[model samples]
Target: MDTKFDFGEPESQNTVYIRRVATSTLPEEIREQVPDLDSMYAVHDAEGEQLALVRDRSMAFVLARQNELSPVSVH
Candidate 1:
């Protein structure tokens, strides 16, 4: 399997972090958007700003790339 690990360098701000988040743990407003899904992928920038919430990890990576951001998985 292909994998990547980020060392959190000075230029990490250019990278986007992808992680799985339980939908039930999200706020009511955000949870309402994905009622059918039990979990989702969260795409966050190095500064911890959420960029997007996708149905899957692959989608998160794709969305990040489309936005010209490098994506790395977090746990």
Candidate 2:
């Protein structure tokens, strides 16, 4: 038997990705929340897990920063 341990940075590490998503492509339930916008920005973590959806790119970045995470553009 061998005993080996590895301690490295977490997979997520508070990093987030920001990208644009068309409102029309979202589900009807989600679409109802942003009736005034045709498109919005989506924030996701390093694991590609969505965190929040905002009406604009700036808001997406702000939201991530507010949560103490680094934001990056997906495209």
Candidate 3:
């Protein structure tokens, strides 16, 4: 079944580290673009992979779309 995720925060600003994930965790077509992710934030390839993640509402989605997440939810 398809699921949704909410990543949380920015790595640069936070001390907590999230779990490490493999690129395979993402969709096959965009797996290569998955960026080095931290507990607080996640980065994606510059090639719209970020946008896809956000659209899917995956954990990486939250990181890629940090601006949209509320401060309360980020924590």
Model 1 poorest 10 in a row by lDDT: 5-14
Please list the Cα RMSD from the true structure of every candidate, rounded to 1 decimal place.
7.8, 4.8, 14.9
Best by lDDT: 1
TM-score of each: 0.77, 0.79, 0.22
Cα lDDT tens digits, model 2, 1-75, are: 588878788746888899999999999998988799899999987778888988899999888889888899988
Off by over 4 Å in 3: 1-22, 35-68, 72-75
Total clashes in model 3, counting residue pairs 3 or more apart in sequence or in different chains: 2
Q: Model 2: which residue pairs collide?
A: none
Q: Candidates 1 and 3: which is better by lDDT?
A: 1
Worst 10 residues of 3 by lDDT: 48-57
- Superior by lDDT: candidate 2 or candidate 3: 2
Tens digits of lDDT, candidate 3, 1-75: 578887886544422222333455655555545454321233334221322233222564456346543211222
Which ranking of candidates, highest lDDT first?
1, 2, 3
Candidate 2 CA-lDDT value: 0.89
Candidate 2 segments exceeding 4 Å error: 1-12
* Candidate 1, position 10, lDDT: 73
lDDT of each: 0.89, 0.89, 0.38
Deviation (Å) of 17 in candidate 2: 0.2
